[model samples]
Target: MRNPEKKTEIRIVLTSDGSSSVFNPEFNQHYHSVFGALQESQRIFLELGLYAAFERFEQINVFEMGFGTGLNALLTLLEAEKNQRTVTYTAVETHPLSMEQARELNFDTLLNCHYLKPLHEAPWNRPVSITPVFDLVKYEGRLQDFQTTNRYNLVYFDAFAPEAQPELWTQEIFEQLAAMMQQGGLLTTYCSKSSVKWNLRAAGFLVEKHRGPAHKRDVLRAIRL
Candidate 1:
């Protein structure tokens, strides 16, 4: 289920304790909050999927499903910096976070153990180039409405769980995403549900399960064959 209350600023939903249910706390902050979900997303999607994919792709393009709060984008910047890789980050966010709140999240701490006060302070929707390391460009839209003109090296399919957002897991969306991937491009998601796996295959991917991050058992890693 979706979050009951929408947070206009940070674009976060309050998650229930150990449940996927997102709700706004009476005091604010979603059920899962910022630090917990974003950190886990980085460890699983970027550290494992995006980073690994970049090793083989010289000019990497990343399409993220949810730009919720720009956490994944921030992590991608740091990862690109450390790996010294060229990345063009294209992210979709129907709900973009506010600059003031994003600044409050202190993303600078995530930048190479050093304080990148500039990145932390960069306003949302502003594409910033950290150079051969990172070039972030954001498109503000719903994931379902995205249409790509170029093939991407990797797709961080980091949307909400299929149970939560079934529309995102449909074969139609997968087919569109498949059209945007170069041969051998990979789509990584934190979900390993059987239906999700089947849908991806229906869209023409070679889907397989992989080790997930903390608290999760398995994740799906799909490659264009």
Candidate 2:
């Protein structure tokens, strides 16, 4: 369980791309990069994570870690519409944002999207259709406790930096996730630290480096083969 005292002090921060993210003093980290939230999501997750897999498969199943602010989910939902593909998105978060906090985010107005509100309002632990093309199931629990019978085609590993939450970036965690994926499944993250790449390789993934978005130099795209 997340510390209640720590949850009381989240601050909203505006990124360079005119998108809003939260800064958590407990973790001493911002939910998205300070440079640009939307750009980071699009560059790392949408373009690299989802679209990269779309080139090979029509419909995709995505599993996301740390679904903060629902930005990546919203972006993936938009991509599903653009490609006319079906997307089943499942996200797991230990400490989810409150209704008040989620409503305060400006993503709806920024992206001209009305579904952002409903996405946050959707019930946890049940599959809800944000649109006909996108289906979302959010788990209000930690990833370690999550058990699934379904294997994913892609993974958006959007946790905080490895320095902040080292447990989530370990070889055991990667192996666990890799076990739940189909062959050739892709896992993309904003982290490209050498230790992270080493651990991904130790867990049976072929890691590739890619040019990152602004302020970040590189990101990782690992394949479970």
lDDT (CA) for every model shown? 0.67, 0.90
Clashes of each: 5, 0
Once fitted onto the true fold, the runs of candidate 1 whose alpha carbons sit more than 4 angstroms away are 1-35, 110-128
User: How accurate locally is residue 13 in candidate 2, as Cα lDDT from 0 to 100?
Assistant: 87
Runs with alpha carbons beyond 4 Å of true place in candidate 2:
1-8
Candidate 2 lDDT by residue in tens digits, 115-153: 788888888888999899999999888888899999998
Please list all clashing residue pairs in model 2, or write none if there are none.
none
- lDDT tens per residue, model 1, 1-225: 223244463333322222121233332434233335555666677766787787778888888887655556666777777777778887776654444445454344434344334444444455777555777666666777776686897998877666567888999899989999999998988778888999999999999787766677788889887
Whole-structure CA lDDT of model 2? 0.90
TM-score of each: 0.78, 0.95
Model 1: what TM-score? 0.78
